[model samples]
Target: MGEFELIRHYFAAAPCAQGGVGVALGIGDDCALLDLPAGEQLAISTDTLVAGVHFPAVCDPLLLGQRALAVAVSDLAAMGATAIGFTLALTLPQVGAQWLAGFADGLGRMAARCAISLIGGDTTRGPLSITVTVFGRVPTGQALRRSGAQPGDLLCVGGFLGNAAGALPLVLGEREAAADVAGPLLEHYWSPVPQLQLGERLRGLATAALDISDGLLADCGHIAKASGVALQVNLAQVPVSAPLQAFLGREAALHAALTGGDDYVLAFTVPESALTTLAREVHVIGRVLEGQGVTLRDPQGQDITPVQRGYQHFRETP
Candidate 1:
């Protein structure tokens, strides 16, 4: 089929592309337009997923669709912005009716879940890759930032960590487990729910925040550097799901929680005074200190930061 026909049948005609709040113009237009309310600022983020690097070259298209958009929208969640719309640039080796149908269904599913509309994008022939650009909005001065953390604030995460890392083996067919064990891990890996509500709730409360796409240690380092404060992560306080522990053992699970990437949970810092309000929503894993960089503490409060923190696209080799 032709490019326009493919897009029309698979994406442009999809319910998500119908346009919603803030999306002034959607597909078929030269450029999509977004209209933000007065006193609100536009928030945007883009994520690209390649065939082999980001996901298995061969996998379920449905899950891939959900994952591609969810990961991108997580950035908006990190900023505590309300999701508005997104554009998809899809590159394919060749067109397949079944693949496009499944992918579009998954994409629409996630868009509905996040309440974000599909605006516009482009299609090209190439190695399979999907790039999604998400748009959101936040009050002029209330967006969460990585540069606002302060010493004496408690460091927290929205939910349990490392389940996605634990699911890697399952994702690649390297391991198998009972449905009870594999279900949660695979769900986390394939369909991570962005902590949008928590982020919005933290607008005025969280001093600094980000979604944990890299390992906790590596991503926390971003916060520390941006905020110019030391983050003391208490090893004992890091929360890991029981399923992860059951799948990888306690020690291995703990290691995954600390260093495994793609968790996509929100990590933020809030002062002691604001902790009460957030006590139920977050897990207190550490505190901010007057210094620089991330310091991981053992049970005895000894520094145990690992040399390998997280994934990077390109890194120097020794």
Candidate 2:
């Protein structure tokens, strides 16, 4: 099949293609149409995932599809937006029916799960890469921003960290893990769940918020710089999962939680009052303070912001 034929059969016919919230028109059109609700603003973001760079070259196509869309949708979650629809631009070195079937199935399942429709996009010949542009809606003036943190706000994370990072060794074939440890960590890395509902709940509550793509310390620095406030992270307070600790020792687990990237969990700040009002379980890692930049404090009250903060694609050697 040609490009348009492939999209028509695989992507355009995916679940949620017929009707989705705010999507006026979907695929097979010059432009996909979206209708925002009254007093709501559109939130849009784009993310690109290259085969060897983002995932192993021989990774499962299904997981790749899920991860690619989830990564882009994470930005909407940080803005406390409700996902409406998405566009997929897929590039491939060559077409393979089995791979396309798995990829489409994964993408469609996630689109259904998120209640987002496939709008419009392009397919081209190139190295294997997937770029998803997601669109969501937030009430006017209520969208969360990284610049809203206040000095006295409390810092929190949606869930445990380091699982994705922990799975990297196994993914790269550098290490082998027992099934018990491998299953959960591999799931975390391949099929990350975007915190869309939690983000919506935090709209008026969190002072500053962003999904943790980079490590906690590096991403927190973004909030610190954008909000012009200092953030003090208590190293002991960072949430590390038991599985991660079991796979890697406490020290290594701590290292992953602090510096490992691709968690996709929301790291946010809320006022003391809002903290009490939070309905879900969240780890309070630290608090915001007057000043600028992020600092890590140990149990002894000594500053120990590790020399390595997180992953930087350009600066790091793979």
Estimate TM-scores for all models.
0.95, 0.94
Best by lDDT: 1
How does candidate 1 fare on TM-score? Answer: 0.95
Residue 38 deviation, candidate 2, in Å? 0.7
Estimate candidate 1's RMSD in Å.
Answer: 2.9
Error of 1 at 206 (Å): 0.6
Poorly placed runs, candidate 1 (over 4 Å): 1-4, 305-318
In model 2, which residue pairs have backbone atoms overlapping below 3 Å?
A: none
Model 2 C-alpha lDDT per residue in residues 7-81, reported as the tens digit of each score: 566767767577577888888879999999899999999999998898888988998888888899999999999
In order, what lDDT does every prediction score?
0.91, 0.87
